[model samples]
Target chain A: MANTFLDRTALNDLLNGACFLGGGGGGPMSGARPLIDLIVKEYDGVTLVPYDSLDPELPCAVVAGIGAPDAATHGPSFSSAPKDAFLKLQAVSGTTLGAVLPGETGAMNSIIAALVAAQLGLPLVDVDSSGRALPTLSLAAYNLATEPTVLTLANQPVTDEQQATAVIETRTAPQADSVVRALLTTQAFEQEGAFSTWLMTAGQLPGASVDGTVTRAIAVGAALREARAAGDDPVEAVNAVLDGQLVRLSCGTLTAFSSHEGGGFDGYTIVLTDDDGHVVTVSAVNENLLAWRSDSDAPLAAAPDTLAWLAEDGTPLSNTDLRGLTAGTRLHLLGIPAAPILRTPLLAARFAKELAGIGFFGQAPRLD
Target chain B: MANTFLDRTALNDLLNGACFLGGGGGGPMSGARPLIDLIVKEYDGVTLVPYDSLDPELPCAVVAGIGAPDAATHGPSFSSAPKDAFLKLQAVSGTTLGAVLPGETGAMNSIIAALVAAQLGLPLVDVDSSGRALPTLSLAAYNLATEPTVLTLANQPVTDEQQATAVIETRTAPQADSVVRALLTTQAFEQEGAFSTWLMTAGQLPGASVDGTVTRAIAVGAALREARAAGDDPVEAVNAVLDGQLVRLSCGTLTAFSSHEGGGFDGYTIVLTDDDGHVVTVSAVNENLLAWRSDSDAPLAAAPDTLAWLAEDGTPLSNTDLRGLTAGTRLHLLGIPAAPILRTPLLAARFAKELAGIGFFGQAPRLD
Candidate 1:
C-alpha cells in the first residue's frame, strides 16, 4: 500500500474514528483539534505508511500522552512534550527511531504520534501498540515483551523556565506504567506528561502490534462523514466500517455523573436513564472499563470491548467530552467489539485486571 | 589534610557522629549498622580522603538514600541500591566517578556513600552536600548549583525478582527532589529508594559543599565514646568536640508523639515535658526541622541547625530510633550549630521552606 498523506479533512476523520475507538478515554478531541491543526499548518501534513513497507529491521518508537485526560486540558499545553520525549529518547538511548507508532488509538495520543512523526520527518506507522485506548500502558500488546524497555517521559515546562524529564528502563510493562503514573504526581508534571516507549524494530511488530489500525480508524471516520452527508445513520455507517461490531446499548438522558481524580487517572461513573425508566451505568478509570444495566448483576460490556458515547449529531464523545455534559443531556451509548488480537487470552487477562480495578470481576462479555 | 582509613572502630565512630548530625531524620542506626558491617567485611575498610587531596578535575557522585527512613528498615534491605545508583549514573553519563561524596551527614546516608566508594574502589570525599540531614535535597548547599544536575534512583527489588531504576536530569535541585519523591510512590520503589546525584568535578566542591564533615563526624563520635568510657557525660563530650556549638535544649520525659506519612516523607511532632513541668515540642518531616518551648513564641532551634535526641545510655537517637521509645522514656535533646557553610543566605531560605512545611513560618532561629 502507498503512504497516505493526511490533509485537514483526513486528519479530522482520523481523529473522529480514533476518538470512537478510544472507548471513552483517549483524551478530549477539543485538545486534539488545535494540536492537529497546528501540526497541519507547521508541517504541512503527516505521512502514514503501511507498517509492512518499512524495513523489517528499522527501529520505531511508540509515542503517547500519559495521565488524566481532563487534567491535561488545563495544564500548560504539553504541545511540545511528545517531540521532546521523542528526541530525548533517541539521544539517551542512541537509537535512531525511523518511524513513530501510536501507543494506542485515541484522538490525542494518535495525533501526538502523528505530530512527532511530522516534526521528525519520519513516517507514522500504520500499526498501533493497542488497537484501542487503554487506561494503562501495561495493557498494550506490544508492551508485553519480556525484553527490557527503555521509556522517556517529558513534561511541559513547569514554569516559563524549567522542564522535567526522566528515562526509565524497566523489565516489565507494569513497572513502567507504575513509575510513569507516580511521576505524573510530581510538581514538574502535575498529573500529565508525554512519553516515548517500546522501541522496536519492524521485524518485532507482526505478533506484538495491531496492524492497519490507522487505516481502519481513517476508514471508520470517513464513513461517518460520508453517511452524514448522504443523510443515512452515521452510527450505522461506522458500524458497517467496523464489520458490524458496534452495538447501541441505550438512548437516554444522562441523569448523573460523578468523578474523582487520583493516581494520575480520572475515575468516573455515569448514570443514564431512558424515558422508559431503564437505567445504565458506565464506569471508567480513564477509559470506559465496564458498563451494565442498573438491574443486571453481570456487566453488559467490559473491556477490552469498547464503550463510547455519541452526541445527537453523531460526533464521538471522549471521556473528557462526556465530563462536560450536564445532567439531562441526551446521548447514545455504543459498544464496539475489540480487535480480535485484543481478545486473545493473554490480552484478555490484562483487560480483566483493569476491569477488576473498577469493581468488575466477571469475564469481558462479547459486544459483537 | 591526609587521607583517613576507616577501620571498624573508625567506621563506628563516623556513624555515631553522623547520626547525631542527622538531627532526628537520618535513617535508623539499626539499618546502617549492618550495612556498615557488610562494607567493612567485604572491602576491609573504606578510604576517606580529604577533598583537597583529589585531582581538581576528578569527577564524583553524591550518594544517598531517598524516601521514608523508617520504611527502609522493613523492606528488602537496599544493601546494594546506593552502589547500583552510583554505577548506573556513571554508566549513563559516561563519567567515571573517582570519589563518592556523601549527600548528607547522616548515619545511613554517609555509610551508603562509604559503601559505594568501597564497592567501586574509589575514595569517599571528606566533604558532604549538607552538613546536617535535611528533609529535602533542595536544602543541600551543593545542590544549589545552577547547572543541570543528573540523578539516578534505583530501588531494591519490588519483589524477589524485579528492580526499578530511573535517571532524571533537571536544571534545579528542587525539580530533581520532586521527581525522585514522586518516583518513590511507584510499585518499583514503594516509598523507599537510593539515589546518586550532583555529579561534579573536584573543582566544584570547595564553595558548593561542607568541607571536613567526615572528620568532624569522626571527632564527635570519638568524643562520645571516650566520654562514655571515662564515666563523663557523653553529651558534654560531643558538645566539647563541636567547640561549644552544641547546647542543652531539654532533659525530659517523652510525652506524646504523632506522625503521618505522605509524599514519601514521615512527618511527626514530638512533645516532651521536663521535671519542673517545662514542655517543648519538636517537629520534623523525615528529619527534626524545628524545636520550641511551649511557653515561648520563639523557636529554640530550626533546621540548618540540628535537633538531636540521645538516650539515657548516650546513644544518638535517629527519628527511626526515637519512634520505638514509649512515652515517659527519659531523653536528652541537644542543639548543634549548623556548619558555617549551611548558614548562608540561600540555604537559609531553603530551610525556611522546610520549616514552613511543619507550620513553623518564622526564620530558622540561630542555635548558637
Candidate 2:
C-alpha cells in the first residue's frame, strides 16, 4: 500500500488491524483514531503507507507521538516540540522524505505517526518498531539485532506557543530508543512521557523503516467500516479484516479508577464479581497500557494484548471516556497489538527502571 | 578573573565572591566548602574560569552537580542526576572535553560545577549562565533569542540505573526547563537526583558567549582555602576575596522540607522567628530558589544579596552536603532574595515562565 488515505469510515477496521498487528504492544485503538482524525482534518492532503511498501530509495521518515492518553483525549493539542523536532531534522540533515512510524507500536503509536505524516506531507509507513504493541521505548525490533537501523532522531515539543523547542540528531538503531524515550520525558515535563523517532533501513533495502504501514492501517479500517455498514457486528468486521477473533466482552464500569498521576495515566479493574466472582480487569498507562486475559478465571499476561470496556455496539470506552462505568454497563473485549512489544526487553526495562524509580510501577512485571 | 583553580583552599572565598557578586541572589555557603573539597579531592585537576574569557573554539559544558544546597541537607542527593545527566550527554553525543559550570550561582551551583568539572575531567567555568542566579532555564543568556545557533543543549537523567531509564534531547533553551524538570521529578521519585549538561556553544562565537569561567571558580575556592588555613573566618576570607561583608544571620530550624522532585534537589525551609513573633521564611526549589529576608520583625523588600548559609565553624554546607541539618537542627540564615520568588517578576520569570508554564503571566505577578 503506497498511499492509504483513510476516510472517517475506515477507522474501525484500521484500528482492529493495528491492534492484533500490534502483536500485543501497540497503543489502544481509541487513542490513535481521534487524534489521527484531528490531524487529517487539520491537513486534508496527508497520506499513510504500510511500512514495507515505500520506495526503497525515496526519502521517508519515521514519525510517532505519545502523551497522556487522557490529555490526548482531552487536551490532545500537542506541544510544538515534535513538529520542531521533525523540522529540525530537515534543518540539520537534507533528508527530503522517508517512511516513518512510531519508534514502537503501542496504543498511541499509530496516531502519533499519523499526526506527523499528515503534518509533514510524507507518507506514514505501516511497519512498526515492534511487530506489536509495547510498554516501553527500548522494545522495538528496530533496536534489536534483527533489523536495527535508525535514520534520524529529533525532539520537538511546544511547552508554550512561542516557547517551542526541537533537536535533530543522527543515531544508531539500538540507541534510537535512548534518544526517543529521553526526548519524551524532556518535551512533556512529566508529560515528556511520550516520544517519537524516524529510521531508515541499511543494506540491500535502504529506505525509511516501517515503509507501508499507514496504507495497511487504512485498508484494515476501510474493511471494518464496510463490515459495520453491511450490518455485520463491528467485532466480526474487525476479525474478518484482521484475521482476528473478536473476544466476547461483557460491559461494566471501572469499579475503581485512579489517574496514577506523576508520570503516566493508569487506571484499574472492572469487576464482575456480581457473577459469582466473574472478574475482569481494564487497565491503561497513557494509552491503555495493558489488559489481562482471563480463561475461566485464570490469568494471562498483560500489555501486549488488552481488554477494553465498551458499549455493546462496539464503542471502546475508558476511565476518561465513561465517567461512570456501572457494574453491568455493556462492555466489549478487543485484543490488539500489531507489534510484539510486550515480549521485548523494552517493557521490562522501563518498568524496572523509570516507573520503579518514580515508585509508580504498581504491579509485578510480566515476562512471558 | 581569568581562571580560578578552586582547590580545597579556595572554596570559601569563591562562595563569598559569588554571594557578594550575586548582589542578592547567590547561594548559601554551608555546603559549598565540602562540595568543593569533594570535587577537588575526587578529580584533583579541577579549575574554574570566568565565563567571559572562554575561547569560542573550546568545547565546554554547564553542569549542576554536588547536592543542591537545600536538597543535600534534606536527606536526599541531587548530585547523582546532574553528574549522571552530563555523562549520558557525552555518551550520546560522542563529545569529550570542554568546560563545565554551575547552571546558576546559588549554593550548589558553583560547588556542583567543581564536582562535575573534576569528575568529568573538564574545567569549571566561573561564568554561570546568569551573572547572578535566576531560577529558570530562560534566565540563562543562551536562550530562544539565539535559536538556530550551534549551542546544542541536551539533558539525561537516571530514575533507575537498573533499568537504565533516562531522557536526552536537544531543544531551544526555553523548553529545556521542562525537560530537565521532568527528569528531576523522576529523580525525586528515585530519592537521589543529580544531572549535568554540557551546554555545547561551539558555533555561537563561543568565546563571546562564555567567559573564562572555569578559572574564576577555582580562584574563588583557592582564596577561601588560604583564608581558612590562616585562621581567618571563612566568611571574612570569602568576603575579603570577593569584596563583600557579613550581614545579620537569622537562626532557626527546618519547619518543612520537600524534594525538588524536578531533579533540582529535595527542598526544605528553616523557620527563623525573631524575638517579636516574626518569621523569616526560606524556600528552595533547587539550591535555595529564593530567600525571604526579615526587617525588624517584618519581611524586607528584595534586600538580601545572595543568601549564603554556613555552619557556626564557618564550614560551607549545601543541601547535598548531608550533615548538620534536621527537622529541628539549628541553622544560620545568610539573607538573600529576601522576597518570595513570586514577588520579583524578573526572578519569577525564571521559575514561572520557563520552568512552569508562561500561561501564568498577566496576573500581575510580583514579589510579595
Worst 10 residues of 2 chain A by lDDT: A353-362
Candidate 2 lDDT over A1-368, as tens digits, reads: 34567555444455555553443234445556666567647875346554446555665444555433444454434434345556655555566655445554433565666666666666655565544444444444545433333333333324344243344343453354444445445443333333434434432222222334544555555654565567667666656654564444443433445554333333333333223334454444443443433222112223434443435554444444554455456555555432344345644454333322221122332322
What is candidate 1's CAPRI-style docking category based on DockQ? incorrect
Models 1 onward score TM values of 0.51, 0.41
lDDT of 1 by residue, B160-243 (tens): 577778999998877888998899987788888999888888989988898888998889889878988888888888878888
Docking class of 2: incorrect
Per-model i-RMS? 25.7, 22.8
lDDT of each: 0.82, 0.46
Q: On a 0 to 1 DockQ scale, where is model 2?
A: 0.01
RMSD of 2: 22.8
Error of 1 at B368 (Å): 2.8
Per-model DockQ against the true two-chain complex:
0.01, 0.01
Q: After superposing candidate 1 on the true structure, give the runs of residues whose Cα lies further than 4 Å from its correct spot.
A: A1-368, B146-148, B158-160
